[model samples]
Target: MNKTNRKKFYDSQTWKSCRKLVLKRDNYLCQLSIKQNKLTPADIVHHIEHFEDNPSRALDMDNLLSVCSSCHNKEHPEKGRKKDKRRMKSRRMMI
Candidate 1:
């Protein structure tokens, strides 16, 4: 596994709420690869960290990025947010 361990920042409801705050902070613009591309708000909120399991960093506005779906999918090729969440949740159950 990647030792980078990005999931360490999403642990509580705080992360979800923080995500909303960050989205509003960025004006719904994708922080990643959005400087030139013209896209709509239908994009995704790309988390700076691949894994979001740590609350402290999860709510950090700096750690969140408002990205469109295309950019978000490009960043994470195989796993979607919903799938990732489910996988992460199941993994937690085993631990």
Candidate 2:
């Protein structure tokens, strides 16, 4: 999708509700590192999976995460596999 459309999609009401649920579920803490870092309310809601795969999932609290921008950036690796893979790897390591 084009940048404009992508921006619109990201800024839609669905995203807004999804983000709100994530923030509420996590109590506004960054779930990635579980850090209570200060951040704008807008910066808290992050997608656990790509929006393309399941945009509807964004609305599901189970599929959302509260994260600061820094950790979110690290979670979303631009050069390698996407954030979801990294999260799975981390989960496997934990187990």
Candidate 3:
């Protein structure tokens, strides 16, 4: 889907309801935090399998994860990783 359509889907009532359900199911706690022996409130309901890659499972509860912004970033690092690579290249060129 295009960016516009993807944004619309996220803004839709269905997505909203699903997000709420995931949060409730996870008890509003960041799932990653539990592994580290910490409790953190989740601010996002992230797709375990990225929505773009597997749109069919977009609404699957088992495919959703309640996560904080930090954990979400770690899970989906493509964008950040690219930026980091660019910065590293620039630093190397300067050295």
Candidate 4:
């Protein structure tokens, strides 16, 4: 999605509720990390399929994923929030 549409979608009540549901369903844990045998706290709800490419599944629960800042950035490098190489390791909770 374009920046304007993306912002509006994120700011909507529908997305707010959907995000909460996805987080709860995933137990607030990063789903990708779990698949790798690492447990991490999830702080963002990500689209498994890019909403920009497939608008029809924008609000589909099956297309949503609970992820952490690190994982989300990995999935969307265009976000330009790549981890700082000079910074210390993140202190995000892990199990």
Name the better of 2 and 3 by lDDT: 3
- Of candidate 1, the 10-residue stretch with the lowest lDDT total is 1-10
Regions of model 4 farther than 4 Å from truth: 81-95
Measured by lDDT, the strongest candidate is: 3
RMSD of each: 10.7, 9.0, 2.3, 6.5
lDDT of each: 0.67, 0.70, 0.94, 0.89
Summarize candidate 1's per-residue lDDT along 47-93 as a digit string, tens digits.
57644345345456777788887777877776576887899999999
* Whole-structure CA lDDT of model 3: 0.94
* Candidate 2 lDDT by residue in tens digits, 7-89: 89779997777677777777776766655545433366767776656766756677778887777777777735576788999
> What TM-score against the true fold does each predicted structure earn?
0.56, 0.61, 0.85, 0.79
Error of 2 at 39 (Å): 12
Local distance difference test, candidate 2 = 0.70
Model 3, span 1-95: residue lDDT tens: 68997999899999999999999999999999889999999999999999999988999999999999999999988858988999999999999
In candidate 1, how many Å is residue 12 off?
4.9
Worst 10 residues of 3 by lDDT: 76-85
Expressed as tens digits, the lDDT of each residue in 10-93 for candidate 4 is 899999999999999999999989999999999999998999999889899999999988899899877644555323345433
Query: Candidate 4 — which pairs collide?
Result: 1-52
Q: Arrange candidates by TM-score, descending.
A: 3, 4, 2, 1
